[model samples]
Target: MASFKIEGGHKLNGTITPQGAKNEVLQILCAVLLTPEKVIVNNVPDIIDVNKLIFILGELGVKIEKLGSNSYSFQADELKLEYLESENFKKDGSSLRGSIMIVGPLLARFGKGYIPRPGGDKIGRRRLDTHFEGFIRLGAKFRYNKEEHFYGVEADELFGTDMLLDEASVTGTANILMASVLATGTTTIYNAACEPYIQQLCKMLNAMGANITGVGSNLLVINGVDALGGCEHRVLPDMIEIGSWIGVAVMTKSELTIKDVSWDNLGQIPNVFRKLGIQFEKRGDDIYIPEQESYEIQNYIDGSVLTVADAPWPGFTPDLLSIVLVIATQAKGTVLIHQKMFESRLFFVDKLIDMGAKVILCDPHRATVIGHNFQSALKATTMTSPDIRAGISLLIAALSAKGTSTIHNIEQIDRGYENIEARLKSIGAKIERVA
Candidate 1:
């Protein structure tokens, strides 16, 4: 396993370009199965999950050509759907949650799809009942054997209809969108996930000839097309990475500029961070975070500690709450971090506390952080990463701590952030990867 050894308490000062969205790239790669013509996607992040998805696609006979750094041209002209039953499929498919998305495109074009239980961050029990529910609504029959943990879906002719998702699950929305694009009739999905990733998928599908409306809203209407043609599309910049950089700047009191950031896509993030006394200036498409001596946490109307919570699209992303929590430790006041989406996410706060952070794990879903204001540097220690966001949060904490810190199980960090240590090192972060 890879680990990060960081000599902390050094201010990070340099320019860094945020990588492309990992979530967007995964689904966009699956979108290639919608057509036989060539499709080129640029600004694709070179991360572990994306690489795993590419390996899985290659095993399925999709011709993927690397054009340049962060660019790839893919052609699913002669995809061998039967390869999905191979051991390669079983191993890779069950290794990540994004693997479930292949089912929709496979079923849409090949009339059958096979998937085992998808694996991802162990934050909570993410139910796929909504995904299967959407598929069954489109006239597909599913059979699952719990003993083998395999799921199969097939339909001779898929007919679309109106669907009201029980929850606006991101992967569930992508699954339905891919499947509905090729159905026999129109499909209306209400309470859908309308995150930037989903909107990008919809735009790419539209360019490929699938008629979709409500690009950034929770209601999506899809007019099924007989066939989708090929088209080139570039993914938008990752908003999560932009937010992470913003947190880093505030936490380390460093002046940094993030370029090519989609200001419009960063809905409510700037405002949310403002509540935590972090400010940034916008220069066209870039965000400039100025150096700060100290940051103060804004209180609520009743003069109590403010709480930051997560919600659906157009709301603050839950994935960023961990980073925000780490940043809060450097601010001058107390704040509550409420992670409504994942129960196990707060458990990692113990590691931060062990490093001399003032934190109270209120419960499985909430924590109260009192900033030390660098009164005392966090002592270096050895810790294990728990999940993707948590792993990155620990990395940030370790980077801000004193002396040396060793973080194990770095694969969790690789699952999301692209070349994180390298990127940080480029930005003057003293971190190295050790095997």
Candidate 2:
């Protein structure tokens, strides 16, 4: 396993552009399969998970061309559908949760799709029921091979129908949207995930001739199109990475600027950081965070402790809660972090506790953080990364702590963030990758 050795108690300077959104990239890459024409994708993040999905698409016979460092053209005219049932597919598809998205396009275009139970962060139970449930509603037959732990959906024809999703699952919404785009009738999705990423997908589909309305709402209507043609789509800046950088700046007392952040799409990220008293200036689309000695958590209007919780879109994203939780260690006051989406994301706080943060784990879902207010410095210690978000959170903790610290299983971090060590080092961070 690869590890990162960080020399802590240092400040970072200069500007950094956030990588393309990893979550959005995953969904966009899978959306390319809905069309046989060449779809050019720009600003793709050079991260492990995204690269893995690219490799899987190449294996499925998508004609790929590298137009630039972060640009690619994909044409899925002659996909090798049989490969999805092979043993190699089970291994490849299971390694990435994004691979599950491939099933939507395959089932829509080829009448059949198969995937092994996909693997991802061990944060909590992320069930795939919503995906197959939506598929069945559109006339597809779903089957689960319990013996092999595999899933398959097949249909001779798809007819769009009105349905309400059990939950606002992002991937599920994207998958059903892709599938319904080529269906025979109109499809109405209630309670759809309308995150910026999903909105981008809808825009891309509309550009490719699919009639989808409700770009930024809980409801979406898709009028079936005969086929989709080639289109160029550019992913937005990674909001999670932007949040991480903001946390890093506050935690390590650094002055940093995040460039071209696509301000309108950031939702509640900036305000959430501001609620924690983290200061930043919005310069056009960029975010400039000046050096901060310490930040204080803001209480509610009625003098209740500030509670930062994660919900669906327009609420604070759950992905950055880990970073917020870690940075709160040095904040001036107390705050409650409720990671409602995932139960185990808070489990990584034990490592922070070991490094001398005052945190009370209320339960699997809630943690009350009593800030050190920077009076007591966090001592460095070795720790293993539990998941992608937690891994970045720990890296921030290590960078802010005194003394050198070792972080094992940095591969988890690489899956989500592209060349994180190099990026941080460019900003004067003392971090090294060890084999």
Candidate 3:
């Protein structure tokens, strides 16, 4: 596995562009399987997971042509449906959680879809029950084989129906939406995930001639269509990367200008950072964070401890809470970070605590961090990355620490962030990638 050896306490200054959305592109790439016509997508990030999904699509006989550095044209002109039964499918499909999304488009267009047990970050138990349940409600036969460890959904014809998801699952909504677009009738999905990723997927689908309504809302109405044509779609900038940049600026006390961050779509991210007493200026489409000597956390008006938690869309994203927690270690006041989505995400705090930050892991889901306010530098040490988000948070912590730090399992980081070391190095960050 590759690792990063970082020299800490470097003041960085430069302009950086946030990469295209990783989660959004995951869904958009899967949507290509729903149409046989050519679909062009722009602003695609060149990362491990995205490339893995692209390779999987190619294995299914999707004709893929690279248009540019950040663009690709894909056509499912002649799919090799039998490839799903091959060992190659099991090896490639099990490498990414995003591979599960292919099931929807395949089942919708070819009336059958097969997925091997998918693999991803081991933060928590990410169940596929919602996806299977949605497919079952859409008149598909769902079966799971424990021996082979795969899932299969098949139906001669899929018809739309009403479904209230057990939870607002992002992938679940995207999966069911893809299946419903080619279904026979109107499908009403309540408690749907309305994240920006989902909204972007719906927009791209509508452009491809799919009837979808109530975008950016929890209730979705998808009118089934006979066929979907091709369309060109540009993914929005990654909000998680933007938020990570913000946290890095504050933690390192560096000046940075993040360009074209799609300010309007960031939802509660800016406000949540503001609550932590981090300030930045918005210059048209860019965000300028000035170098700060120190930043302090804000307490609630009732003099209670400020708590940062995750929710669905239009609220704080769970993906960014780790960044918020790591930056909080250098602030002036105390705050609680409640990671509601994943149980094991907070386990990395022990490494942070060992680095001299004051932290209390109250339980599996909550941690209280006491800020150091630049009064002292964190002593760096060697650590292993637990997941993609946690890996970045640890990198940020190491960057702000006083001594050298080494982070292992950097493959987890590369799976999401595109050319992360190269990008950060351009901004004067002291990061060296080692094999």
Model 3: residues >4 Å from true position, as ranges?
A: none
lDDT of 1 at 242: 88
Q: For residue 276, give model 3's deviation from the true position in Å.
A: 0.4
TM-score between candidate 1 and the true structure: 0.98
Candidate 3 lDDT over residue span 185-295, tens digit each: 999999999999999999999999999999999999999999999999999999999999998899999999999999989999999999999989999999999999888
Candidate 1 error regions (>4 Å): none
lDDT of 1 by residue, 1-435 (tens): 989999987887878788998888889999999899999999999889999999988989999999999999999999888787777678779998899999999889888999989999989878899889999999999999798699989999789799999999988999989999999989999999999999999999999999999889999999899999999999888888888888777766788999989888888888888998887899999999988878888999899889999999888999899988998888889999999988888888899999989999989999999998777777789999999888988888888888899999999999888888888888788899999
lDDT of 2: 0.94
Against the true structure, candidate 2 reaches a TM-score of 0.99
Per-residue alpha-carbon lDDT of candidate 2 for residues 1-435, written as tens digits (9 for 90 to 100): 899999999989999999999999999999899988999999999999999999999999999999999999999999988889899999999999989998888888889889999998989999999999999999999999999999999999999999999999999999999999999999999999999999999999899899999889999999998889989999999999999999889999999999999999999998889999899999999999999888889999999999999999988899999999998999999999999988788999999999999999999999999999899999999999999999999999999999999999999999999889999999999999998
Alpha-carbon TM-score of each model against the true structure: 0.98, 0.99, 0.99
Better of 1 and 2 by lDDT: 2
- In order, the Cα lDDT scores of the candidates are 0.89, 0.94, 0.95
The worst-scoring run of ten residues by lDDT in candidate 1 lies at: 245-254
Q: Which candidate would rank higher by lDDT, 1 or 3?
A: 3
Question: For candidate 3, what is the lDDT?
Answer: 0.95
